[model samples]
Target: MGDFNQSVVLEAIRRSGEGSSRIELAEATGLSAQTVTNITRRLLDDGLIREAGRTINGPGKPRVTLRLVPDSRFAVGVHLDPAVMTFVLLDLSGAVVRRTSAHTPDMEPRRIVEAMAATIDALITGSGVDRTSIAGVGIAAPGPLDAEKGTVIDPPKLRGWNRVPLQAVLAEATGFPVVLEKDTTAAAVGELWMRRASADDSFVFVYLGTGIGAALVREGEAVRGSTRNIGEVGHIIVDPDGPSCTCGSRGCVEVVCTPQAIVAQAAHAGVFPEDQGMSDVDAVEARLTELCDRAADGDALADGVLRQAAAHMSVLTAALTNMLDVDRVVFGGPFWSRLADVYLREIPDRLERASATRAVRSLPVDGTVVGDDVGAVGAGCVVLDSVLSPRASALLLGH
Candidate 1:
């Protein structure tokens, strides 16, 4: 199953959904008929796939359709956000079998790992699935990650999370191999899997969590850069005259596009009070929600603040689209849903105005089909992906 040929054959059947005949698989994967026969035989014997039914394709003999066994394997995906931690159990078919979420504990990194291990235990046990059927756990965490070391390198949102070796430690604590992924990249992978996009589909995933980041998808694959950490847009100066950032830059995405930044704008506009300090994540989340609600209810000041954010975000979007030349733009993360209505309404026209290819094409902007918990769902799918859909590329998993 680790072979590239095997991955091609298995992915063909998985994508077929209704099922595919051996002849269809051979043609779809460009594998020889004999090779497809041998691989399908092994897959059926191993219970990863099964003969669903027989089909008559104007043939001499009826062709047996092969389909993936959705329940044959399971995976755990965890989204480690500073505000909330989301968990999901996914089957081989990429369906969420069970899920849960909890507020993140403000503790040391090791203590948070302990909490993750415990929650993963309850998620599997409560679902009544055997432990051995579980493949591994995938952690979608905030980045500048040391992918080779499997450690997160001081994400601003997660206090005290320095160079913690998350992959090795979580594997030891849970007794399952762990994969650490940048939350944005994981969300892109999750969208790729769930969206079932065409082979030529491409987009830039704008992940709006505690921070703002981007992920690339090219030819239906997540494009993780050299260090497995691309799309670090935090310090990209979006508004030269906007607020100052920790990186000693003014109007960076971290200071202008993030929820905290939006909340700061709201407070400054007197749409909301700034009693809670700007660094408080939960308070920022609540305030952001309220600000959105106010805008929805026709509060002009609140709308004005969000529109300004959308304008700054369009600057970021134009930068990415002009440089990358993707097919479209996708928005997702824990904070994406609340911001969707305004962002959708506001970002398109501004982006169109700033687009490098506006003359050739009108760039499409849409929210993630997988919704807010996409980070967790995509993390779980990452584990499943490592198993079924292997890529012939430089993509690297964080240990």
Candidate 2:
């Protein structure tokens, strides 16, 4: 059977969870019953799926149901942030069987790649899963990188990473196919797949990390731009005359609304301890956490800074929703876990008041239920997506 038909049948069964009869599979995948049978037979032969008893719903004959064999395959997902490196080994069902994290080494490409290779080995070995069953590794990194070539192109604040061929290096070192994706887009994919969202649901995912970025998911597919570098929302101009950005622009969202920017604003407002140093990524993360904690504890200065940051972020969020005509926005990442409540409370009002379609619909802002490991989980989903998810592109090829 062709791979496209196989993927369609497999995805339909997988999405159905416990099981789906051949008839149900055909309906779900828009494939004929004979095609579904042929594909399922091939999948069964490959141990990718198995019959899970039979459904007898007052029928003349019992209908066989099919389910995915979760242990038949696995994949590794790596999230490389400026501050931390997270690794997760996921089974066919997208469950994280094993997970680990370590502080990201200094941004030397060779050192980071070597460390990642070791980490990948450790995760696979420690999981006790069949090594050969592992599909590949999916990596989510800060972007502006070339996704086509799988190279890391000069992400902000990460030194020594200029057009580094990360995918090829990791593939060579780990002996597994490697797929690279932008962190935000990977997270958005993770959300959609993990939630089993229908094709009609579309939303904008707002990612808050060392920096801010976004991903647009329309009809269950992430909009990968011509260069696959679409969601660099950080550069959206929020304030025309506020401050000069690194990109030689005035008051971009990235320059004014990132965690670093919030931390800087707090420091300037004399919120940090006199002896505290905010010179590096770790320090900035620590300070951001401290500020969030203080704000949660009702510290006036900390609350003011966070609210101010949320206000700036609202400008960007509102603009994105208005421009895209999307009604849903999701916030996630390490920093978002701390600031979720404040953002959920603040962003919706700004969105409704400023939205072009306020009279027709209300935009809802929600926090990620995937927790802090969203990027890592999403990274793993990239590998699963490549192997199992059905795509419309398959139709063009006559699959």
Candidate 3:
């Protein structure tokens, strides 16, 4: 009947996975059966939900099951890294239907926005999904951003993106509502939504990309700090006596455990060719992938560099987990595929030894189920979350 009620009913059906009955929806949402019936009628009429046969119990009347129509809606997710831009189209179920990628172009805000809009247009046209059914675009970009204003504020490696009104620009360019979020936070949202995490689940998502960062998710919501810049983990000091960081700190995680740092370490360890110039993002990514491949193939020097990076990552991760009192940690991002094995193996042991709750609970470290595209998919989930997920603010507004 209203936005709040609609979101609650839809969320219940989506969370039900296979399907749910009105009785089940009423129980899950804590709404009256009459209210669930009215909302279900509206959803059915709107084609957002459909009857999926019936469940017949022994002596009672057969109850009809309703399920979300995945084709009823679609959302586009864009993950903009310093090196690459990933685009994904996701359905109501958070399944990626079509995906594409391109090298990040110039840092000029207008050009980047136009390029992204063009890519979105191409994706929608290629997918042949009804244009009206498409929700909007969600962007996951490197942050230190003004999430409330949808502005990019001096993120590393993006030279010209200083206080750029990215959300408004993208909205204007594409004629679609836009939701902008930090890449790590968006990745955490994606994991929570895609995995259908209950409100009780809590975890920290470690995002390994060109730079390293993290997002703390508690009760299925990402912890946005006072300025909505909570996940700046790169600056966390891991080694007090190690190399100096650009943040004017010694042995910061960003300076020691990032992809750039790992590649630099590999180069120093004689993993790359002497003449190879790691001046550009592409060069660094290429060299890093080569190093990971070599390490996987039993190159001792490369393996040692990666293991050392993983160890540094574990320290930061353990600290975050202990401070936040979360039981799980998830790793994801473009660089994650290359470093997942090392992190999984190395982080768990370090966490077990370092965590304050080690005697009470064993923390689990795992990779994202969405794989390397978790950030992009999470971006898309941001849009769906905004539209379908119920929020406390709605109750305050009496929606």
Candidate 4:
């Protein structure tokens, strides 16, 4: 179990934060001092960790402290949206060491896939990190996804993404393992990595992007159902007589709360000038951000439009809290960064008044500070989990 102990030594240092002395590592891991020294030597030779400093522990000797060398390896995360594709490169410590973005190409999947491969190759080469040290790549696209097979299975956001073997294709190009996850789940994972919060053993992440969805994470793993679509909160019919969704439903949460719906409502209210480019969720969000800024600065028309959007969002929050029974709700994606204040103020009130369990308990909602990069950063964390997590790593290593 030399390798296992070595891995544990590295993880212990990481969990202990900045640096840990040899004695600290031995105590923290319940391993012998000689075993820790041996593991640290191998880690140092592998360039995975480096000495941070030395502490004088006794009269005769000083103990060297060890810390992760963030640049030891890199993992990449790609978030695919209709309007823009965000790429993030994270070092071993799960920090975004580099980032790049580009406009999403037309609806052709092949062209978009090729472009993604090219972009990744260029980024890796430019950074000059050894290819072997690249642990894995995580791709967070919309669902319903075939998580087992790593396929994108008919995501409403990407029209032609049906049955696409994105994981295998990307693995072939990058020569590293690829993990495919739903965008909302990625956002939840991102929140976990960023917050390192242990508030609950179980929580739900409400992701507001092109559409609203929830990712239920329990005990450090996302919950996927038999069909691999456990958290499709967007299609949860909140109002049967409301509005028709493209899924042919009358008043699903997505139909009323998506960015597209907000922009459409704003256009109908004579807020935005037109709806040509606002068709894209990202474009609509950018426009909405501008509108929110104007509204916050006292634009009467913009204020009304944003308020309407916030009201719809509030309704969705109330419905989710009632259904999920989750104590903690993490608000994520690009929308949270711009409209978090709006949701934070309006949602709790709505939940208190309308939530089914309001009389029994209070549901606390908070927006993730990780913001727009949450999905990308969370994707990187997913890959790191594959390497470090007990279950995920065992499966990956075929032990």
Best by lDDT: 1
lDDT tens string, model 1, 1-399? 237788889888888889899999989988889999999998998899998889887849999989999999999999999988999999998999999998788848877988899999999999999899999999999998999999999888888988989999999999999999999999999998898888889999999999999999998899999999999999999999988887888989988999988998888889877686978788889899999898899999999999999899989999999999999999999988898888999999999999989999999999999989999999998999999896875244457
Worst 10 residues of 3 by lDDT: 390-399
lDDT tens digits by residue: candidate 2, 1-399? 478888888888878888899988888878898998888998999999998898887857899989999999999999999899999999998888999998898888898999999999998998899889999999999988898789989998688899999999999999999999999999998888777878788899999988789999998788878888878887798878757887899989877888877888898888985456665889889899999999999999998888888888899998899899875998998789998867877888887899999889888888876778889989899999999987878668453
Per-residue lDDT tens digits of candidate 4, residues 170-196? 888777788887788888877776666
Q: What is each predicted model's overall lDDT from 0 to 1?
A: 0.91, 0.88, 0.88, 0.77
Task: Give candidate 3's error at residue 98 in angstroms.
Answer: 0.9
Per-model TM-score versus the true fold: 0.96, 0.96, 0.97, 0.86
lDDT tens per residue, model 3, 265-363: 887878876666765889889888888898889988988988898888888988898889987999999999998777777778887999899889899
Q: What is the TM-score (0 to 1) of candidate 2?
A: 0.96
Residue 211 Cα positional deviation in candidate 2, in Å, after optimal superposition: 1.3
How far in Å is the alpha carbon of 214 misplaced in model 3?
0.8
lDDT (Cα) of model 1: 0.91
Weakest lDDT window of 10 consecutive positions for candidate 4 = 390-399
Candidate 3: lDDT of 70? 96
| lDDT score for candidate 3 against the true structure | 0.88
Candidate 3 backbone collisions, by pair: none
- TM-score rank order: 3, 1, 2, 4
